[model samples]
Target: MSICILYYKMFMFYSLCLYFLSLYLLNLDFTLYLELNILTLNSISIEMIVYFDWMSLMFMSFVFFISSLIMNYSEEYMMDDKKLKRFIYLMVMFVFSMMLVIMSPNLISILLGWDGLGLVSYILVIYYQNVKSYNAGMLTALSNRVGDAAILMSIAWMFDMGSWSFLNYIDYFLMNKEMIWVASFIILASFTKSAQIPFSSWLPAAMAAPTPVSSLVHSSTLVTAGVYLLFRFSDLFSENFMSFILYISLLTMFMAGLGANFEFDLKKIIALSTLSQLGMMLVIFSLGDKMLAFFHLLIHALFKALLFMCAGFIIHNIMNCQDIRFMGSLISYLPVTCSCFNISNLALCGLPFLSGFYSKDLIAEILSMQFMNFIIYALFFISVGLTVAYSMRLSYYVLLGDFNMMSLNFLKEEKNQMLKSMMILVFLVIFKGSVLIWLMFPTPYFIVMPFYMKIMTLLMIFAGILLGYEFSQIKFYYQNKSLKFYHYSMFFSNMWNMPILSTLGVSPYFLTLGQLYLTKMDYGWMEYYGSKNLFFLVKFSSQLFQSFSHNHLKIFMGIFFFFFFFLILSFF
Candidate 1:
C-alpha cells in the first residue's frame, strides 16, 4: 500500500480506538479531585485534576462525540478534493486540539490548546487561498488573536495572584475583588471567539471555505470555544460581572437575530443564527447556573452540527449554491437532506417536542429567573420571536418553494455522500437529547416544566413563523436609475484630501530624515568628517570598536549593560 493510504488507515484505526476508549472511560465511576498542587512550580508532575465532574463531563463528551462524527463524515466529504492529505492533517490537528482544550487540567494548558485550535481553524478557513478566503482567514485570525490576548492576560493575572492552577484559581476567584475584571476580560475573549455581535462579520465571510470546514468550525468547535470558556470559568465571574455578561448576551442575541433577517446567503443566515445560539448559551452561563448551561451546550452542539451538516449537503450536492434566494424546492429530489434540514431547523426554532425546545425553554426559564421583570422578559420574548422568524425563513426559502435545479448535471454520487452524512447528523439530533437527559438527570421530576411558560413559548414560535412567511411574500423593487445617479453625484466627492497631502508633502520630509539617520548609523564617515580629522585616528579606532560591537557576544553584552543601567537607575 502507498504510504498515504497506510497513514490514513492508521489514523482511522486510532480514532476508532480513542472513541471506544472514551466510551469505556465514561462508564467507569471515576473519582473527582478538587485540590491545589502543593508541589513546587516547574515540576513535571502528572496530576489528575478532574474538572469534568458530571456537568463538565456531559459537555466534553458531547464535543468529542460530535467531533468524531464530523471527522468520519469529512473522509467522504473531501474524498475527491485535491488537497486531501493536507486537509486530513489539519482536520485531525483541529480535533486533537479541541479534545485537549476540553480535557485540559490547567488554565494555561487549556489556553494553549485553544490558541492552537484557533490557528489550525484559520488555515482551514483560508484553505482555498482565493481573495475572499484570504480576507476571511485574516479577519478570523485577527479577531481570534484579540480574544487570545485577552485570555493570556487574564491567565497572567491569575498566576500573578498566586493561583496558577485551575482549582486554586476558582477557589480564590470566588472571593477576590479582582475577579470582576478577570471575568470581564474572559467574557470579552469569549465574545470575540464565539462571533457575538460586532465581532460576527468574519463568520459569514468564512463561508468561502468548504462545507465540511464550515460544519466543523462554525457548528461544533471554533465558534463554540467562547461558550465553553465561560462554562469552564463560571465560578470566577462575580455577580456584578454576571449582570453585565447578561446584557452583552442579550445584545448579541438581538443583533444576531436582526442580522440573520437581512442575510441572503444560506450560510450567512446559519452563521448569524450560530451567533444567536451562542448568545443564548452565554445567557445561560451568566445566570450562574452551571447545570443549565451545560445542558444547553450539549443540546446546541448536536442540533447546530446537524443543521450545518444538512446545509452543507444542500450547498455541496443538491443546488451547488449558498444563497437562499437561489435555492428552491429540494424536498422531492433531496428528501433525506430536506427532512434533516427541517428537523434541525425546528430544533433551532425551539419548536415543541424537539431537542431544541427543551434546552432553549430551559434557557428562557433561567433568564426569567435572573431578570424577573417585564422589560427584560419582553425583550427576551422578542429575541426569541426573531429566532423563530429566521429559522423558518431558512426552511421555507430552501425547501418549500418551487423546484429550481439550476443544473441537471449536479453530481449524484456527491449527493449520496452528502445525504449519508446528513442522516448521521439527523439521527444524533433526534436522540442525543434523550440520551443527555437520561445520563444527566434520570428522573421524571428532574424534567419538569411549567405549563404556562411552555404554552407561551410555543405560541411565540408559531407567531414568528407566521410573520416570517407573510414577510417573505411581500415584494419590493429597486431602480437602476438611483444607482446611476449616486455614481455620478459622489464619484469624486469623498476623496481623501488629507492622505493625498500627506503623501505629497509631509511624508517626504519624514522619509528624508529617516534616510539621514540610516546613513549616519550605517557608516562612521560623517562623524569623522565632522571632527575634521582632529580625532581621525580615534574615529578610525571607533570604527574598529563598532565592528567588534556588531559581534553577537558584544551585542548581548551591550543589551545586558543597557538593562542593568536602567535597573540601577530605577531603583535609585
Candidate 2:
C-alpha cells in the first residue's frame, strides 16, 4: 500500500478510538507532569514543565480526532501536488504543536507549542508558491508575530512566579496590580490569533490557501487556539478586563457578520463566518462561562469543517472559481455536495435540534437572562440574525437561482475520497451536540426569560429567511446595482477596506522610513563616519609611512620630535 493510504487508515482508526476516549475522559480528572532541564539564567535552573488534566485530555482527544480526519481528507485533496509529502509533514507537525498547546498548563512550555503553531501555519499559508499566497502568508505571519511577541512580554512579567506554570501560581497573576498588564498582553495575543476586529483582514485573505488547509485552519486548530488559551486563563482576569473583552468580541462578531453579507467569494464568506463564531465563543468566555464557550467551540468546529469540505467539492467542480455570483442550481448538478453544504449551513443557522442549536441556543438564552445593557443584547441578537440572513442569502445565490456561469462548465466528477471523510464528519455535525451536552453538562440548564425574548432567535431566523429570499429574487437588482460606483457599497464589500488599511497603513510608512535609513544612516552618515573617513585616515597614514621609508624620513622625524618637544614644554 502507498504511504499516504497507510497513514490515512491509521488516523481513521485513531479518530474512531478518540470518540470513545473523549467520552471516557469525562468521568475522570487527573494531572500528569513531565519536567526537563531547559535553560539556566543567572545560575538558576529552569525546567520546562508540562501539565495535563481532564480539560486538556478532552480537548486533545478532539484535536487528534479532527486532525486525523483532516489528514485523511487531504490525502485525496492534495493528491495531484508534487509537494504532497512536504504538506503532510507540516500538517503532522502542526498537529503535534496543537497537542503541545493543549497539554501544557505552563506558559513556559506552551510557548514552544505556541511558536511552532505560528511558524508552521505561516509555511502552510504560503504552500502554493504564488504572489497571492505570498502576500496572504506574510499578512498571516506578521499579524500572528504580534501575538508571539505579546506572549514573550507576558512571560517576562511572569518572572515573579519563578516558574512557567501559570496554573501552579495563578494567584500571582490575580494578586499583583502589575500582573493586570500580563492579562492585558495575553488578551492582545488572543486578538491577533483569533482575528478579532482590527486583525480581521488576515482571516479572509487566508482563503488563498488550499481547501484542506482552510478546513484545518478555520475550524478546530489555528483560529480556535486563541479562544482556548483565553478560556484556560479566564479565571485570571478582573471584571473590568472581562468587560473589555466582552465589548471587543461583540464588535468582532458584528463586523464579521456585516462583512459576510457584502462578500461574494465563497471561501471568504465561510472565513468571515468562522470569525463571527470565534467572537461568539469569546462572548461566553468573557461572561465567565468557559465550559459553555468550549461546548460552542467543539460544535462550531464540527460543522464549520464540514462546511469547508463541502465548499471545496463545489470549487473543485467549478474549475476553482469561488465567486458565488457565477454559481446557481448546484443542488441539481451536485446533489451530494449540495446536501452536505445545506446541512452544515442549517446547523450553523441554529436550526433546531442540530449541533449548533444545542450550544448556540443555550448561549443566547443565557445572555438574555444576564444583566447586560440594551446595546450588548441588541448586538448579540443582531449578529445572530445576520448569521441566518447571510446563510440563506448564500444558499439562494448559489443553489436556487439560475446558473450564472458564462460558459459550458463540466461537473461530471464523483468526489469519492472527499465525500468519504465528510460522511464521518456529517454524522458528528448532526449528533455531536447532544453527545457533548450529555458528557459536559449532565444537568440541564433552566433559563428564565419572557416568552417573547425566549423565541427571539426563532423570530430573527424567519425574518432573515424573508429578507434573504426577497433580496435574491430581484435578478435585475444585482445586475444594475453598481457596487463600484456606490462608494459606501464598495467600502463594506471590500471587507471594510481593512486589507488596504493594514497593508498601506504599515507598508508605506516603513518603506519610507527604510528609504531614509538606507540613504542617511546606512549609505550617507555611516559611510562617512565608519568607512569613508577611516579610508582617508588610513590613506594619509600610508602616505606618511611611505614618505618616511623613502627620502622624507629625516623631515618626518624632525616635525614629529618638534611637536613632541612643544607638548612636553607646555606640560612642564
Candidate 3:
C-alpha cells in the first residue's frame, strides 16, 4: 500500500516536472550536463554523469507515469499471488534501472542501467515458476546478453578516447575512423535490446511474465531501452550503418504486423504490436528524425501499457484464458475495457486525433518524402495496412464475434484500481497527441503531396478494416484456409521461424562448442599435460624418496665402502 502511494506521488511529480522542464528547455534552448568525478585512471575519468534535457525529462515522465499505473493495476491483478511484495520490489527496481538509462549520457552509466534492465526483466519474466516462464526468461536474458556484450565492447573500444562519455564526443567520431566501431557496437547493442529482426523472438516469449510485468517490460522498460539508447546516439551513426538499421527495422515492422494477425494469444498480439511500433520509431530515427521517434515512443508507451492492462483485466475475469478465439463478445461484459481497448487499438492504427496519429502519420508522410525504391514504399504501406488489419481482426475476435467461452464465465469491468489506471490513460490516448504536436512543433508542418498520396493512409486503413472483417468471417461450409496452408501459415505465425532460429536453430552449435571445449581444452589437454601429469610426477618423486628413507642403513654402508675403495685405489 505504501509502495502504491509512493508510485502515485512520483507519477504526479514527474508529470508536473516534465511540463515545467519542457517549457524551460524550449524557452532557454540549452542543456545541462553534470559530471561528478569519482576517480581518474590513466588520464581517463571514471565518473557519474547526468544529462538534463527536454528529451530525457519527457521520457522519464512517461516511464514514471506508466510504471505508476502498472503498479496500481498490479495491486488488483496480483492480489492472489504469494510473493506480491517481492514482485513490487522488482517492479520498483525495474523503473529505477530505466531512470538510470534515461538520465545518464555516459556509456558506462548507461550500461549500468542497461544491465540492470536485462537482469531485472529476466527475473520478472520467470516470475510464474513454470517451465514456459523459465524458457522465456532464458531466451530474454540470453538475447539481452548479446546487447550487454556489445556495450562492453563499445566501452573497451572507447578506452583510447580517455572518456566513456560518448555523448560528449559525437562530433569527434568523424575525426577518428575507429570511433565508427564504437558506433557499430552501440547500434548492435540497440538492436538486441530493442528485439529487432533476429532478436525479436524474445519479446513475444516474454509474455510468460505476469501481465503487469508485461505492461511495463513490453511498453517502456525493456524493449524501449534499445530504441532510447540509439536515440541518444543517433548523431554518431553513419549513413551506411543507418541504412542497415532502416532495412532491418522495415522488415521487423512488416513481420510483426503480419504475425499479430495470426497470433491467437491476447498478450502475444499486444507484444507484436509493440514490436511493430518499435520498428516504426526506429525507421523514422534511422531516416534522421530522432525527435519524431522520441515523440512516438512517448505516445506508444501510454497506449501499449493500457492495452496490456485491458488484456490483463479480461484474462483475470475469464479465469486466465488468453486465447482470443475463446474470448468473444467481451464488449457485452467489459464495455469500459472494450472501449479503451478499441481506442488504443485505433490509436495504434493511427486513427486521426489519437496520440499515435500525431507521430505515425507524420512518419508515413516523412517516409513517403524520402528518396527510396519501390520496395521500401510498398513495404511501408503494406505494413501500415497490416497494422490496422491485425488490430481490426483482434477487435473482431475479442469484441464483436460470438461468445466462445464456457457458459460459466462471468466477465465484468474491474471498477476499482484497474479501471482508474486505464481511464487515466484513455484520456491521455485521446488528447496527448494534439497536445504534444502543438508543444513540440509550434509551426505546423507543411506537407506538399498529390491527392492520391495524401489519401494513402486513410485508403490503407479502410482497406485493412474490410480485410480484417473478411478474415474474421467464420463460414463452416468453407474449408479453413489457414489449415490448408498449414506450413506456410505456421511460418508467418511463428514470427517467420525466428523463435526456432533463436532457440532450436542456434542452441546446438553453442552446445557443440561447449562440448568440444570441455573435451579438448578443459578436460583433455589440461588434464593430461597440466594436472594429471603433475600429479603422477609428484607421486613418483614421493615414492622414490620413501624408498630411499626405507633403505637408509644399506645406503649409508654402500657410501662408506665406496669411499674406502676409492682411498685404496689412490694409494696403489
Candidate 4:
C-alpha cells in the first residue's frame, strides 16, 4: 500500500511539472502532431493521428493534475479497505483514459477513451459491492453508453469526410452538405456525457461511488467531457442548433437548482449543484464562447473537487450518514473542513473576489449583454440566484445553527492525508479562476450593458443568500402546507422526475414492445408460418403417402397414371 501510494504521488508531482511546461508551450503558440500512418485502400483513405494544441495540453494537464490529487486522496480514504490497490489502479486507468480523450484528434481513437471512461466509471461506482452501488453503476454506465453509441455513429457518419481527425474541419461541418450528419450526433453525444436535460439522472445516481471518484469524475473530468467536446466543436454548430441547445441547457440548469433545494442528502445536493453548473457551461458553449465555457470548466473543477473532498471528510466523521437533516453546526466541530466547504460553496455561488467571481460573474455579465429573449434573461439571472440560494441553504443546514445529530458524536478534521490533498486545491479554488481567465483570454471582453443590468449579479447573489437562509429555516417536513401540494413539490424535488423518466419511462416502453414482439412475432406468426405449421404439413403429407403405399396405394396410383397417359395420347 505504501509503495502504491508513493508511486501515484510521484506521478502527481510529474504532472504538475508537465502542467507548467504545457503553459509555456501555450504561450509560444506551439502545436505538435504525430502521425502513425495514412492507409489508402481503393478510393477510401483512413488517417490515424494524434494532435496536440494549447487547449488539449491545457485540458489534459488539468485532468492529470486533479486525477493525480484524487489518487492521493483515495490512498488514505481507502486505506481501511482490503482492495485499496484495485481502487488506485482504476483511478490511474481513469486518468489515462481521460488523457487519451484529450490528446486523440481522431474520432475513432476518442471512442476508445470515451468507452473507457464509461466502463471504468461503472467499476469505480460499484467499488463497494452493494446493491445500491450496483444499481447506480448500471444507470451510470447505460446513460454514458448513449453518448458512446452516438460517438460511434458520429464516427460512421464522418466516413464521408474521409478524416476522423475533424479538428481541421471545424468550419467545414457547417459549410459542407454531406458533413452535417456528423455534427448533430456529436451534439447529442456531448449532451449525454455532460448530463444535459434528458440524460441528467445518471450523474446524481453515480454518487453511489466513493467520494474520491465523485470528486474526480463529477467535479472535474467526466461530466465536463461533453462541455469540452462541444467547446472543441463550437464553430460547427448553426445558430438554430445553438438556440435549441441553449433552451435545453436552461431547463437543465433550472431543474437542477430546483432539485438541490428539495434534496436532503448531503452529497446529492452537491451533485445536483454540479448538474446546475454543467448546464450553465452548456449555455456558454452553445452561445459560441468556448473560451468562456472552458474557463468556467477549469475553475468549477477546482472548487467542486474541493467541495467533494470536504463532504467526504464530513461523511467520514458522521460515520457515512449523508442526510444533511441530521447535520448542523459542523463548523463548530470540524473547522478546517467546514471552512473549505463554505469557500467552495461561495465560489459556486460566484461570490465576488473569490475564485468563482472571475468566471461565473463574467458569465452572468456576458449573458446579460446578449440580445436574448425575456425567458433566457430570466432563467440565467434566476439560476444565478439559485446558485447562491442553494449555497446559503447548504451553509445553514450543514455549517451553521444548532447541532442536529441524533446521537452524541465527536467529529474532527484531523484526516491529514485527505486534508493535505484538499489544501492543494484550496489554493487553486481561490486563485485558479483569476489565473485561468488571464491565460485563456489574451483579449478582454467588451461588455456594453445598462447599469441595472451590470448590478444584476449583486442582486442575484444577495437575493439568493437571503432566500436560501430563510428557506433553510422552514420545517419543510413538519409543515402541513407542504403536504397539501405533494405533486408539485415532488415535481421539483425529483427534478421533474427526470430520473424516473430517463430510467423507467424509457426502459418500460421498450420492454413492453419487446414483450409484444416476443408474443406476436417470435412466438406466434413467425413460428407458425416459418417452422411449426410447415413441419406439421410436411409430416401429415408424409404420413398420408406412407399409409397409401402400405395399403396397395402404389397399384392404384400406377393404374390412375396409365389411364391418364392413354387419355392424353388419344387427345394428342
Candidate 5:
C-alpha cells in the first residue's frame, strides 16, 4: 500500500477508537446514575466515589470531538509523508494521553498522562529529524520538563500533607499554608506549557515541525493543556492568588501581542498569537469565574485552530514558504482558504459579532470589575491595540497583496492534499458552533459592554489594518553594517533574551561536572589522594586492627551480627 493509504487507514483506526471511547464515557455516566439508584433502593452499604464532574465531562467531550476532526483532517494533511505510520501512532498516543489527563482521578494519574503527552509531542516535533526540527523538539521537551517537575513537586507536597485523591484533597490543598509554593509551581507549569512570557520562545521554534503538527500542537489542542490544568485547579488558586495571576497574565498578553506584531514567519506569528490568546484566557481563569473561562476556552480553541490551519494552507498551498514577506494575492488563487483565513483573522481580532468578540469581551468585563488600578486597565487597552495590529498584519500579508504567481503555482502543483485538508478546517472555522457550542456560565457581575465601547474596539482593529498597510508600503534600504546590526539587535532584544540566557546559563553546569570527572581520570586524583603517606599509614593501622578482629571472616560474621542485632531489636 502507498504511504497515503496507510496513513488514512491508521487515521480511520484512531477515529474508531475515539468513537468507542466517547461512547464508553457516555455509558459510564449512565451506569453511575444506575448504580446510585440501586444503592438508594437496596440501602446497601456501598462505599464509592465519583470524580467525574461537569468540567471534566465538558473538556473530555471537546477533546474527543476535536481529536476526531484533526485526525480525519490529517488523512489528507499527512498523506505523502514518509513516516506516515509513526505519525499516526504518535497522534493516537497524544490523544489517548490527553484523554487520560482529563479523566484522571488523582494527581499521580494526571502527571502520568501529562508526561506521556509531552514525550509523544516532542517525538512528533522532531519527526523529520532535521537539525532545526531536532532543536525545536529539544526546546519543547526542556520547557515541558521544567513544567513537569513543578507539577510533580506540587503533587508530592500535597501527598506529604496526607491527601492523594484530587477530588477530595483540592480544598485542603488550597487552604493549606504551604499552598503558596504549590500555586507558584502550578504557575510555572502553566507558563511553560502555555508558552507564556519567558517560555514563549520554544513555541515559535516549534514551527519546524509539519504543518499538521504545528496546527495541532502549537495552536489547537496540546498547548492548551497548561490552561486546562490551571482551569481544573482554579478553585485551589482563585481565592488568594487571583490578583497576582491577573497581573502576570496581563503582562504575558501584552508581550505576546508585541512579539506577534514583530514576527514575520507565518507559523511563528500564529504561535505567538496563540500564546497571547492563551494569556488572555488565563486572565479569565484568574477571575474566579468558571463560566467565562470555560466559554473562552471553547471559542479560543475553535478560532485559533482555524487560524493555524488557514496559515498552514497558505504556507503549503499558496506561498510555498513560511515567510509572510514571500506571500501575496493568494485570495484569487485559493479563494476558499483565503475566505476562511479572513474570517478566522477577524475572529482573532475580536471583531464584533464573531466568536472572539464575545469571549474576549467577557474577559475584559471581568478584568474591569476585578481591577481598580488604571495602569492595568491601560495595559489592557494597549494589548487590544496590539492584538489588532498583529491579526490585521497577518491577514493583509497573506491574502491581500500583489500576486506572486511563481510561488502560487509551485504550491498548487505540489500540495493539493494539504489544501483539501485546510479547506475542511476552514469550513469548520466558519461554522464552529455545529461542532462545539459555547456554554455561558454564571458570573457575579453582568458582562455587557456599552455599544460605544464595542464600536471603539472594532475601530481599533480597522485602524490597525490601515496602519499595517501604510507600513508595508514604505521602502527602506539596509546599506550599512552598523545600521543592520543595530536593527537586528534591537529586534531580538525586544523579542526577549530570557530564553537564550536560560539555555546558556543551564548548559555549563552539566558540562562542568563531566569535565571535572574527565580531569580526575587523567590525573589519577582519587588514587593520589588515597595513596598519600598519611592516608597509607592510616589504612595500614586500620587493616592491622581489622586482622586482629578476625577480618578474613568479617563478611560472614558481619551478616550474622546484623541478623542477631535485628532479632534482639525486634524483641525489644
Candidate 6:
C-alpha cells in the first residue's frame, strides 16, 4: 500500500530469495552462468555475462538486506529533508551499481559498475551543498579515479585475451608473467578503492556525506568493493604481490586504529574504524585466505552498519553535535540507542561470540599459523590492540562521562523505524557470528598453536582497554599533553599526514608544474613563435592581399599613363 511497505517487502523478498539461492548453490557446489549476446563483430561477440556462484549470491543477499535496513532507517533519519525523493533515487542507484559489481564477472561490466559507484558516491558526498562537502566530494572522487584508471588499463590489457570475462581466465592471469601487469593494475585498483595507506585519507573526509550514506557506503558496500574485486581476482595474485599487499594492509590497519584514538569527530572516528577494519580484511585476503576475508567482510558489515545507525540516532537526538567531547551520559538520554551502540562497539573489538570475533579471531589465529617476520606479527597485534583502545576510548567519552551538552537538549531516541532497524542488527551482532561460522564452515579449520600464542589476542584486548581508560582519565588543567606533543599527535591523528600528502602536499607541486608549463610554453615560447607569430603573419599577409586587390584597377590605369609618359619622353 505505502511506498515504505512496498520498498521493505521488495528488498526483504529479494534478500530472502537470494539467501536461499546461495545456500542451495553452496550445498550443491553448483554455479550458474548466463550470457546475453548483445552483438557480434569481427568474430568478437559482445555479450553481457552474469556469474551466479554461491559467493556472489551470498554477497548480494547481504547487500540487499543492508540496503533495505538503511533505506528504512533513512525514511526516519532523512525525513526532514526537502529532497527525500532525490536521496532515495541516489540510494537505489547506488545499490543497483553495487549489484552490478557483485553479479558481473566481465571486466567491462565491472568497470561500468565501478564508475557508477565512483560517480554516485561523489554526488552523495557533496549532497549537503557546502564548501566542506565540495572539498570532501572532490577528494573522494579523485582518489577513487586512480582505481578507475587502473581498472581501465586492466581492461585494455585483458583485450589481448579474446573476451573480457576475467572469471574464465583466473589461472591464465596467474600462470602468465606477461599478463602480470594486468594483475598489478587490479591490485592497484583495489588499494585505492579500499583506501589503503596513501589513498585512505578520503575515507574519513567522506564523512561529509549524510550518516545514512556513510553507513551504507563507508561501512559495508563502497569501501568493500575493492575487497570484493580482489576477492574475485585473488587467485591471480603472485606471491610477491600478495606479500606487498600484506604489509601495506597491515600498516593501513595500524594507522587507522591509531588515528581513531586521537580523532574527535564522531563520524570520522567511525570512518577511521571502518578504514581499520578494511585493512584487516585486506590483510587476511593477502595472507592467502580469500574466504576468511569475505567472512570478515560480511560479519563486519552487519555490526558496522548497526554501529553507524546507532551513531546517527545519537547524533540526531543530541541536536546534531558530533564532537564526542560534548557527548556524555548518552546512555541516560537514549538508552536503547546507546545500548545498541555499545553492543556494536564491542562486536568491533571482537568480544567473544560476537559477530567480529568469528572472523577476526580466526584471522589472528590463521596469521599466527603463517610464517611471518617479527615486524609483521608485532604490527598485527598492536593494531588489534589499537582497535580495542579506540573503541573503549569512544565508549568512555560518549556513554560513560558526565553530560556536557546544554541542559535543555531534548535527547530522546526515535521510537518506530530507526529503533526497528537497530534491533534487527543487534540480534545479528550478537548471534549472526555463530550462525555464519556454522553455515560457512561446516568443517572447521584445524588451527594448532601454543597456549601463550593463543591467548595473545585476549591479552592485547585487555591491555588496550586499560590503556584506553588511562588515556581518557588523564587530565591537566593547564595544557593538554597532546598539545605538548602536538607534532606527534597531529601526525598520528592526521593519518600520518596522508590527508596532506593526498591533498595539499601533492597538489601544490602539480599546480606549480602547470604554472611553469603555462609560462614557459603557453605564455613565452609558444606565444612568441606559435600563436602570436602566426597571428601577426596571417594579419600582414591578409592586409597585403587586400591592398593589392583594391589597387589592382588603379595600378593598371597608372601603368598606362606611365607608359604614355615614357613613350612621349623617348620621342622628344
Q: Provide the clashing-pair count of each candidate structure.
A: 0, 0, 0, 0, 0, 0
Clashing pairs in 2: none
Give, for candidate 3, the lowest lDDT window spanning 10 residues: 474-483
- Residues 1-572 of candidate 4: C-alpha lDDT, one tens digit per residue: 57456755776776677778778888998888887766876655666677778787777777877877777778777779888778888888888888777777788778888898889999999988999999889889988988998899988887766677887777777678666677788888998888888999888899999999999897667888778778767777788889989999999999899888877888899999999999998888777788888888888888999999999989988989998888888898899889899989989998777888899888888887778999999998898888888889989999987787866797866657888888888988888877887788878888888899999889888999898987687646535654755566667878888888877888898899999999999789898998888999999999988887797767798889999999999998
The sequence of per-residue lDDT tens digits that candidate 1 reaches over residues 317-393 is: 75467767767777766777788889998888877657887778767766655535676677677889989988877
lDDT of each: 0.70, 0.84, 0.89, 0.84, 0.69, 0.90
Once model 2 is optimally superposed onto the true structure by TM-score, how far is the C-alpha of residue 17 displaced, in angstroms? 4.5
Stretches > 4 Å off in candidate 1: 1-52, 161-163, 369-371, 405-415, 443-454, 475-572
Query: Tens digit of lDDT per residue, candidate 2, span 214-273?
Result: 998888888988888997788789999899999999999988887787778999999999
- Between candidates 5 and 6, name the one with more favorable lDDT: 6
Question: Model 3 TM-score?
Answer: 0.91
lDDT of 4 at 201: 89
Supply the global lDDT for candidate 4. Answer: 0.84
Q: Which structure is stronger by lDDT: 2 or 3?
A: 3
Q: Which is superior by lDDT, 1 or 6?
A: 6
* Ranked by TM-score, top first: 6, 3, 2, 4, 5, 1
Best prediction by TM-score: 6
Better of 3 and 5 by lDDT: 3
lDDT of 1 at 81: 76
Encode model 6's per-residue lDDT on 220-264: one tens digit a residue. Answer: 679999999998888888889999999999999999999898778
Model 6 RMSD in angstroms: 3.3
Could you list the CA RMSD of all candidates, in the order they appear? 11.8, 4.9, 4.1, 5.6, 10.6, 3.3
- lDDT of residue 33 for candidate 3: 90
Tens digits of lDDT, candidate 3, 100-219: 999998888899999999999999999988999999999999999999999999999988888888877877887888888888898889999999999999999999999999999878
lDDT of 5 at 213: 71
